[model samples]
Target: AGDPAAGEGKVAACAACHGSDGNATAPIYPNLAGQNVAYLENALKAYRAGERGGGMSMMMTPQAQSLSDEDIADIAAYYGSLTP
Candidate 1:
């Protein structure tokens, strides 16, 4: 796995909606902290590949597009490391 701390900056855009702590202020956005790593990684991949659809699909597509496999792994680790 890559460094979780290094992925924090790349994930800053997510914090705007998901919150730095992953507790989204908006009810529509799901909380990401403590989410299952495999689930989170799969969802991101789905969004990037357009296999998922919803408001989040568009939002996440672009975000996930630039992420490498390692980036995804690190991000999943970072969020999974957080407490709800």
Candidate 2:
């Protein structure tokens, strides 16, 4: 089973833009549901490290900054577990 508490709080920030169901409201935002874990992790890492450049890169940098490696892994797992 997944950690519901961490999923709730940690995913709260993501829900605003990504939606509670993981479908993005805008075309500019990518939908994360069912995406590959490695892909999600690499994207987050890229955004956090500024290797990926875009409006999302800026918005995600601060959010990703405070996340531990485990936190990222869990989130990737959670989102990847969701259905698109």
TM-scores for the candidates: 0.89, 0.83
lDDT of each: 0.82, 0.77
Write candidate 2's Cα lDDT for 17-60 as tens digits: 88767799788888988788788888787777768776777789
Tens digits of lDDT, candidate 1, 1-84: 746686576678888888888788699999999888889889888887878887768788888888888888888877877899
The pairs that clash in candidate 2 are none
**Which parts of model 2 have CA positions greater than 4 angstroms off?**
1-8
lDDT of 2: 0.77
